[model samples]
Each structure stands twice: as structure tokens, then as C-alpha cells.
Target: MADVHELQSLLGSGEELTIVCHNNPDPDCLASALALGRLAAAAGIDERRILYSGEITHQQNRAFVNLLDVELKPFDPELVVDRSERSLLAFVDHSVPGANNAVPEGTAVDIVIDHHPAEDVQARYVDHREGAGATATILAEYVRDAGLDVDATLATALLFAIRRETLGFLRGVTAAEYEAGGFLHGHANDDLLAKLSTPSVSGATVDAIADAIDNRSVTGSVLLTHVGRTSERDALPQAADYLVTLEGVQTAIVFGIIEDTIQLSGRSTDARINVGTVLNEAFGDVGSAGGHREMAGGEIPLGIFADYTSDDDQLVAIVEQVVRARLLAELKLSEEDGGE
Candidate 1:
């Protein structure tokens, strides 16, 4: 059982609290932040703020927020964060600093609530468990254990986040996630949940998919693709996830140049491989990146490479080669000798 008293004590102290999800607001992130906010409110913390850095790319995520009427404000790095003011910041779903879903410059993080393994923590209070399927699941447990009344909208958000992050309980999830999922299943709004499951895809998403599929190159069970100039960084990971579902594919790597950064995402359906290790081993020195066993992502600064075309294909090929080599090395398959 969590020490609700500790969490409640943190909230009841009249300190300003800001709840933030990673830059790209996925269902799990959105759900976790809102659930935390709900908990804080129950503890009489009325000034709690939920801030987001990136836009909601998926229709389902937007719809989920709309249905829940969650009031999330856009994160402006310029919003003066006074360190001396004794403010508290809590992050959900992601742990890395400067991540797309992370707060911009000049924000102080005080607490972290996450399901992913802690890559690095600058926060004062953190609860990180890689075993939990979704951050929302952990938050759900907090609300339930606190005996707080969770509304239908919040329950729907939790259910959607748990379902998506766990891939309907087929991925790296735990018993606690299942218990929270069961609770949400009983209370969530059925109509809102259904709508979020298969929301309408925008033209930009369609174009992004076409480009990703068209650029794909398959080697063994791995499919590598590039999408250029993505307005939505989260779409790259989602696209990589989509490619892994192909008939012959067991792993997928997608790269894109968003602004000046070379972003990469990797996914694997196979149980024998850990994509997180592949990313950390390959790009850890260049930039911050870490994630779960099967899925991971990272980014590299483009300025390091010389005379790079900055074209999507060229940039992707570079990132892909690095990731592929690292994955092969992790799997004990190399260019010189293919081990049996």
C-alpha cells in the first residue's frame, strides 16, 4: 500500500504543484496527469496546474481530453518559475529531461510519477516502477486507495490509457495495472471509450503513414522507415509501432527530423530483445533516451554530422544504421560473422 499520508502531506502543504506529462501527450500520459490532478484536488490542493508541452497528435487523445473535460494548459517555458517560490513539479509517464513531452527551459521538477524505469531523476520525490503497464494505473491506485470518488470521465481516461499502453494487456504490464483496469472497466464511459479507440485520422496522419510505409526498408524482422518534417513528434513513434504489426516484421525503427533534432523510435514484438538497451547503448552519449524492454526512443543533434543533407532519407539512414548495428550487436548478430 502507498503511503497516502505522504502524498497527501505533500499536497496539503499549500505548495504550488504542476503536473506535467511528457512533451507528446499520449493517452497514458494524459490520463496519468489528470488522475494526479484529481488526487491533488481531493487533498485540497486547489492551485494544481496540469501543463503540456506538445500538441495532442491523435484524435483519440484529443477526444479523451474533451470527453473528460480535462483543463490542460499549454506549457510555456517563459512562464516564470521562481525556484525560491518553493514550487513542486511532478512528471508522469516519462523521466528524461529535454524530452519532447518534458517541460521546457527554466522549470524545476520536484516529483515524478512514472511506470518506465528511471533513466535519471532530477526530481525531489519520485515513484518509478517499470513493472506497471501505465502511469495512470499507479495514479488510479492512489485515487482508489485514498477512497476518493473517481468520476466516469476520469475512469474512462484511465481505462483508455491502460488499454493503449498495455496493448490491451498483451505487453509489459502487471497485476496492479490489471486491477486498476478492472476498476475503470466498471466505471468508464462506454461511448467515450469506444470513440477514443478508433478516432478519425487526419490528412496529416495519412500523409505521414504513406511516407513512412513508402520509405520502409526491411532487413530480417526489422523494418526501417523515415518520415520528414513531422509537426507531431509523437506520430513517429506511433508509426514505428504500426510498422511492427506487418506480417513479416518483428521489429520496427522509424526516424524523423523534427525541427533540427534527429528523432528515432524503435519497437519490437519479439520477447528475446530489449530495444531500450539498444537505444541507450547506441545513442546514450549523444542525447537522452530510454524506455521499456520492447519499445524505446532517442534523439541526436543534427549539428554533429558534417554536410548532412538534413533530408529525411539521409538523416534516417544515419540514425537507422546506428540503431541497427546496436540492435544486432545486442542480439549477437554482426556484419563480420552471422552467429547461428
Candidate 2:
């Protein structure tokens, strides 16, 4: 368990605070960042800036931001962060410099509070509880322990984040999450959560899911699909979630092209397979990838690989071939086990 007083003491030493959310901020990270902002304010840090990298293309994420009025700035590469005593940099939900974030490599980080699996995290105060389902659970622990008054908006964000991260207490849920949910239940607005649960779905997301269904292939107990190209990277995870329910499929991986990067989202029901470890083994050397046992994602850049063809179809084919081969090989699936 992390010491909330120690976190408060660390914040008290800083004059300014900057909370950074990982690339493509989700409810978990957004709520965690917002809650951290509140903590920093409570710690006598007046000036605060919450920033996020990448696109907020997810519909539910958009709803959460608009409804909760969670203020955040888009990460600007040209913006220079003052590293003097006036500034303190903190990361929420993600615990690294460049990995899964637009923050430059080797950048100084003061605080890191996250629930994901991480390695070589460099921060002055790091509270990485991998056992917790959501980073919000950890933040809730602080909020509950420190006796910081949580308003309805903040409470709703935290509660919604916990639910989303744990898939409604179905996946990756822990005791901390349940405890946090119970505490937040009184404060969180049920009406807001209902609205957040059913946000407008983009046509692009539906199209991507359709494409994934058309392109799916099964190898042993695993299903792999490529959606060709997509503007909504978050749709990959949704498609993965949908595909994982396919009959006889124990695991599902959905991938697609987003500009020059090949992005992937995977889910697994098989106890034998740790989706995060499988993804790291398959793609970590080529790009960046990892997550919990039930959920995983990867982003691989197409540098030399994109030069294989001028046509988009050819590029998709190449990516499909490479991704399929790599993942199946890592899973030790034989060609004889392949199916459509």
C-alpha cells in the first residue's frame, strides 16, 4: 500500500504540478489524472496543468471528458517544460517516458501512480500496484484515506473509470476495486454513469468491426483479424472484445493500420495464455507492447516494412502476413491448426 501522506509531502515540496495522461487517454487514466490534480491542489500546489498525448477518439472517453468537464491540454512537442523548482511532472496510469506516451525519452518524472505492469520505471515517488484492477482504485485509496472530499463529478469519473477498466468487475478486478467502488457509490452520480455507458458510436468503429469480421482467421484456439486501416485506434480493442466471444475462440487479437503504425488489441480467456506476455514476446522487439493477462495492446511502426508496396492493399496484406506469422509462431500453433 502507498503512503498518501508521503505523496502529500512530495507534492508539498513542489510549487507547480503537471499531470500527464498516457497516449489516447482512457477513463482510468483521465480520472486518475483529475484526482491527482485535486490532490496537488490540496497539497498547496496552485498552478496545475493536465496534459494528454494522441487522439481522444473513443466515444465514451469523449463523453466522460465533456460530462465531467475534466480539463486537459493536448501534448505539444514544441512546448518546453520547466524542470526547475517551480515545476513538478507526474504520470498517471502509465509509468514511463516514451513508451505509450508522447513524452520524450529520459524526461524527468517526479511521481508515477499506475496499475499496469511496468519495468525500469524512473520516478521519485512511484506507486505501481499491479494487483489493483484500475489505477483509479489506488487514487480512491488515497482519497478515502486522506479524507479529501470528492465531489460528484470527480467521484463519477473515478467510479466510471474503475468499472470500465475492470469490465464491470468481470475482468482484472481485485478487492481494491470492489472497496473503491463501494466507497465511490455514495458520491458518484448514477445518471452520469448511465449516459457514459452508452455514448455515440462512430461509423468508423462499426466499419472497422465489420472489416475485422471479414478478415478473421483462427489458429488453434486463437482468433486474429486485421481491420486494414482505421482512423479510430480504440476500435481495435472493441473489435477484439467482440471477436473474443466467437464460438470456440479462447483468445482474440484485432489489429489495423493507423498511419505508419500497426496497432493491435488483444483479449484472452485461456488461463494458459497471458495476453500481455504473448504480445511482448511477439512484438516488443519490433515495437512496443504489453498489458495485463486479459488485455494487451501493441504499436509497431512501419518503417522499412512500409516500403514493401505502394498500394494500401499490398501493405495491409504484408502486415497481415507478418502479424499472423509472428503471433502464431509465438503461440506455438502449427500450420495444421489453422482455420478460417
TM-score for every candidate vs. truth?
0.87, 0.97
**Cα RMSD, each candidate:** 3.2, 1.2
Q: Any idea what lDDT model 1 has? A: 0.76
Those runs of model 2 whose alpha carbons end farther than 4 Å from true positions after fitting are 77-81
Least accurate 10 contiguous residues by lDDT in model 2: 77-86
Model 1 C-alpha lDDT per residue in residues 1-340, reported as the tens digit of each score: 4566787777776456787767667889888888888877887777778888757767777877887788888885544254335466778887655665655543567667887766566666677878787888888888888888878888999888999988888878789888898877888889888888888778887788788888887766767677866766767877988999998887787877777777788898877767777777767787766688888888777675525664666766775566567656665655554211
Tell me the lDDT of model 1 at 79: 40
* Candidate 1 residue pairs in backbone clash: 22-101, 23-100, 23-101, 23-102
Question: Which ranges in model 1 have alpha carbons more than 4 Å from their true place?
Answer: 77-80, 83-86, 96-108, 120-124, 305-307, 310-340
Candidate that scores best on TM-score:
2
